[model samples]
Target: MKLLRNILFTSTLLMSAFAAGTAANADPGRFMDMKKSVKAPIGHKQFCQDNGWACPRESYDPVVVQLNEELWQQLIAVNAEVNRRVKPMTDNDLFGKEEHWSYPVNGYGDCEEYVLEKQRVLMEAGWPKSALLITVAKDVQNSGHAVLTVRTDHGDMILDNQIEAVLPWYSTPYRYIKRQSASSPVAWTGIADTRVTTVSSVSR
Candidate 1:
């Protein structure tokens, strides 16, 4: 059980680091605004077809979680634990397809899978379905990537598999693209990020 103890220690440390970065709830500018409705990602569409329960489409009022210390700690623990437990494997290698989104059944998945798992965990923990959003973005390399966006009264915080510490939407390096709408879990909305940046894909 040595490995289990080490994992617990690491999770605690992650939660502490996230709590230290806590900020008071701010104005509307801190929250990322939604634009026109957009189509859901292909992988997500197929994922919904297969796992409908995970993607709740029922209409409800948008929820912005009031970020309390307890919830903040929980988010950190969930984010870190999932990132640590799940090994990164691309869709093609794992499913023989270029793009596939599903839970990490074998403890392996790509970026979007991480997002899905985290969202699921939080929902199971009593977090609202409207608050946890599956977001798409262009990574630092300008490659397509996925991250979990958690809406809260403090702001729109991002829980990314690539990064351990939760970050505000604006603080992330990604050029915001689109995400599931807060009002409707299945509906998608565009992110009007007008920031211009130059990034080129790196060939290994």
Candidate 2:
């Protein structure tokens, strides 16, 4: 009877460990819960118009990259490299406008510009356009900001100019507003962030 009880206890411990591991890794590719489509930001709309070649309006299969050590390292490297390379300046300082979204012209740009460059570099490196999205959010200061969201098996990761480390979307301090649709670059989808009491407008 003692041996039998010991065996049962060992079996229970093994099962419990397996369950915990499964729970920890569950939904590795889980995506954000998004709400209805929203209007693209004015700055992004204008950006599409000015840089027609960069904006493609066709629907395609959205991709979620399978994340691995190599891919995660790449994300870290790219995020750090860009954050180090670009000097941050407000849109008014760079373009003499309240809001302007474009690539950094002379190694200087605003938040959105850093997002643009990162998107460009990733896309050029063969990352699908569908997996890379331009996201708008309210920063810790409740001011508008932009960041690049990368869809992956490990969930949505954020690459930001203000932050040196690439982080999972939920770990960021910003209140997500909206982002480019995964199906089409021209479309936008609203993020259902419970933290947001009001759907405030974003300028970046």
Candidate 3:
């Protein structure tokens, strides 16, 4: 009887925690929208060639900024899945070379694959392609890194492999560089008008 009581108590606490998290998880009004500059990193073409990943031929209309409980739920679900499923690996370890970007065909892939998969899944799930962008940023080590940026009415929230939680762009630790333009997915665009020197990564 005592053990049963303990288990019930723990379950209650867990539910309470989840409720609090859901309530506090997404509050767009607290964040003011800001612009960040971007530039395409070198070797993208060669990287695409090496990995057999096709570059997007064209762009699409940006997803209308619609932020509600459902959109936020979708964002949270996708971000959590990608973060958990894709193992972190460098291009060198995975491909014996650098900048080898591709979608995750197997269970493991690099950072770029994480972004690609997230973009693909969200699109398949009926999210607008334009709102989903494969973004490259400079990490804490100044190394080039990739993430999927989801544009919404609240702001641009980052969906990253290194982090499980979806956060506003300004909350991340990396410096925003270049991202795929919503109007043209194949073409890159700058994140202009802002500088993000440090954004805290959820995990190392």
Candidate 4:
């Protein structure tokens, strides 16, 4: 049901959001500390190679800030554009191999590739490289998915390929897991469940 709804609603939502032109915290503390995370997802590593990413990710420091409104709009524009342009085709469909990740050289790639392009464009847009992270999460199906998580003074904002609506980390539907450490885009970390746990407590 969720998958069906996502497929059905994504294009509609994208059009509406564009027509409207519309677009966290102690969490900031951990992001500032930026602990070492698990090894980067294997798929991400391969994607970099296949895509010819400059490798050995730069910025060993975590970029921590609540992006100003203007910057937020820029990020939103790029996220929505790439999400709109790239059509999701699995590695098997595109490359005949399972678990392969790469650039959407032809704009036909899977989730992780969507993420890499978003991050790449964001960085190219002159956004700080350290703050824009290529993150991994568990989709509704419990399969590993990739997203671009932008850190800020308030918390984290998620730029996902699955949904055109950019969501606050706490509001997103996926189960939070780990993502690239803000310090280094290459190393990932087990995202503390703190954001969701606190929000749930407050709601109740």
Model 4: pairs clashing at backbone N, Cα or C within 3 Å: 24-154, 24-155, 24-156, 25-28, 25-154, 37-188, 66-153
RMSD of each: 7.9, 10.2, 9.2, 9.7
> Which is superior by TM-score, 1 or 3?
1
Model 4's alpha-carbon lDDT is 0.65
TM-score of each: 0.82, 0.82, 0.71, 0.74
Model 4 per-residue lDDT tens digits across residues 1-204: 443344236534543443322112232232323334567677767766765554566667667665566776676788899988999898898989888767685879998789888888988877777778777666555567788888776457678988777655644555556677666656677665543222221000
- Show the lowest summed lDDT stretch of 10 residues, model 2: 20-29
Q: Taking the tens digit of each residue's C-alpha lDDT, what string does model 1 give over 1-204?
A: 453344335544654554433332233256777899988888888999999987676889998898777787798899999999999998899999888889996999999889999998999999998999999887866788999999987678889998887867765667778899988878988886644245432221
Each model's C-alpha lDDT? 0.79, 0.79, 0.66, 0.65
lDDT of 3 by residue, 1-204 (tens): 453344335434543544422222243232233344344455455555554434556656667557777677788898899878888777788878766777774678888878888988998898888788788777766677888888876567778887676766655566666677778655667653134424432211
What tens digits encode model 2's per-residue C-alpha lDDT throughout 42-117? Answer: 9999999999999977899999997766676777787888888889899888899999899987999989889999
Q: In model 1, which regions exceed 4 Å deviation?
A: 1-28, 197-204
TM-score of 3: 0.71
Per TM-score, what order, best first?
2, 1, 4, 3
